[model samples]
Target: MRIATYNVNGVNGRLPVLLRWLAETRPDIVCLQELKAPSEKFPAQAIADAGYEAIWHGQKSWNGVAILSRVGTPVETRRGLPDDPDPSQSRYLEAAVAGVLVGGLYLPNGNPRPGPKFDYKLAWFDAFIAHAAELLASGAPVILAGDYNVMPTELDVYKPERWTDDALFAPEVRARYASLRAQGWTDALRHLHPGETIYTFFDYFRNAYARNAGLRIDHLLLSPALAGRLTGAGVDREARGWDKTSDHAPTWIELSEQAPRTRSASGSRPSRAAKPA
Candidate 1:
């Protein structure tokens, strides 16, 4: 079974690219971030026509997320983070698909630090950490996949020194990501190919893809229950060069066929998140 995550940037504007990738790769399940469309605007019919079932939480022209499954109905378990510091942005979604509990998130791209946006990012991280701990304790097979936004280590960034002060590479954000790792969640790509120079995102500017200058911000972290089954992981780097494609290509993990079929822990609801309050 293969599971993938993508930061599509814009669902409507990139539908063709999205459909093409879906057709070509045919991952068993897909978690999509940056839908940038409201709930009513989600192209449900089109997605269904592509042989998948979807559940999404969307916000107008901003953060949004969804889960697509071809292997089973994506029975939604949660959507918004409980007590999210900002419940107005559509940043998180969770569901039980093909026997795995999947949590898809689009962490904030807090650009400049020492400001409100940066503070909000940290707060959101805190909430996510708390929620993740609960998920960990559930003892169910789980895969938390999406564009986490923050590049956790020097290995994850093209040039570490150049990103020192950027919110995505700042010490605080990296530490939060480390916390996730310490909690026993395995970063699938790095775990499988430990010294490899792998990247999931290339800048739309400066010929980044051509130069192989990119960031590995998109991830598929497996909970302890699902870690051992991970067999392969990779970035569809060539997709970044496709026309009208997102800066992010699909990042995925392949699991052994003997996956456990279990339900997910619940209680969060789906809602469009707004600006940080």
Candidate 2:
């Protein structure tokens, strides 16, 4: 199976771009971030017309997330992280698509660091880490994919010196990311293309894309069960070149046919033929 993650920027304004990509790539499952649309305006019909079933958590003019399954409707798992009794933003969404538990998130950018925004980002990361620990203990095949907004290492950024003061490249942020991965979640792209300068997002400024100056903040983290099935992983750099596209590109991973079974909520094994829904 092929699963991909993309930050749409704005679902409505970029519907055509998204549809075109779906037509060209046809990923079995896709995790989308930055919908920037309210729940009622998610364009579900347009997505269905493109031959995908989706579940989304949306907010007006800001953060949002969704999971699209080309084969079936993804079963809703959760809407937000557990500890947040009242999350005002739509940043995380989880669902079961083709037996894999997919957690799609749009982590905070935490710009202009050393302030409340930066503190909030760190707090949210802590909540995510706590929930991730629970998922790890469950032993279910899981994937945490999306724009993490943190460049985990110098290797993930271009001209590391230039971003020394940027929140995305902050040492504290990177450390938290490392702490999460240290829990056994494999960073898929890095696992497949170690030490390579693979990038998935480029700033619209400075002609970043044309200059190939980008960052690999977008990531796919696989649980131990799915990590073993990883056969290939890469960024769809061409997608970033498309007109009216999001600054981010689609990053995907492929799995072998002998993928291990995922434990379902009821403690039962999910079937291979159990198409998405």
Candidate 3:
């Protein structure tokens, strides 16, 4: 199965580009971020016309997320982080598709550090990590995919020194990311390429895409149960050059078919005896 993540920036404005990519590179499952629309404005018909069924959590003008399934309707597991009882901004959506629990997140882009926004970013990370741990404990095959908004390492950015003070590259943010990984979530791209500098996002300014000066802030983290099925992972860098596209290019992974295991009636969780491909 092939799963991909793309931050559409503005889903309505980018519908055509989104449809084009959907046709050109048909991923079985897709996690979308930055919808920038209210729940009612999700363009359900257009997406349906493109042959994908979607479940989305949307907020007006910023930070929305969705999960799309090409094969069937994704059974929604949740809409927002449980830790936040009354979340006004949409930022997460989880669903089950093809037996995998997919968590789509649009992490905060805490630009100027040393402020409330930055503090919220860190707090959100903490709450997210706690929920992630809960998901891990459920023993379900899970994939957390989206624009994390945190550059985890020097290799993930074009110039480490320039980003030192930025919240995305702040030492504390990186440490939190490392802490999450220590819990056994595999960063798919890093696991596959190791030493390569792979970027999934490029700034619209300074001819960043042309210069190939980009950041790998978007990521797909796999739980231990699903990591071993990972066969390949990469970024569709060329997509960044598409007309009126989001800063983020599509990032994806391939997984070989695994032996079938007992599943719940909803096929949300695989049995413990399940083996990797």
Model 1 per-residue lDDT tens digits across residues 1-277: 8899999999999999999999988989999999999999999999999999999999999989999999989999998998799998889999998889999999999977879999999999999999999999999999999999988889888888999889999999999999988998999877766666778888989988888888889988999888877767777777788998999989888787664353211211112111111
Cα lDDT, all candidates: 0.87, 0.87, 0.86
What's the lDDT of the predicted structure labeled candidate 2?
A: 0.87
Candidate 3 residue lDDT tens string, 1-277:
8899999999999998899999998889999999999999999999998899999998999889999999778999888898863388788899989889999999888767999889888888888899999999998999999999998889888888898889999988999999999888999877867777778888999999888788899899999889777777878777788999999998888776773343222332212111111
- Candidate 1 residue spans exceeding 4 A from truth: 259-277
Query: Which rank order by lDDT, best down to worst?
Result: 2, 1, 3
Q: Is candidate 2 or candidate 3 better by lDDT?
A: 2
**lDDT of candidate 3 vs native?**
0.86
Q: Per-candidate TM vs. native? A: 0.92, 0.92, 0.92
Model 2: per-residue Cα lDDT over 182-219, one tens digit each: 99999988876665688889999999988878899999
lDDT of model number 1: 0.87
Runs with alpha carbons beyond 4 Å of true place in candidate 2: 260-277
Q: Candidate 3: where is the Cα deviation over 4 Å?
A: 259-277
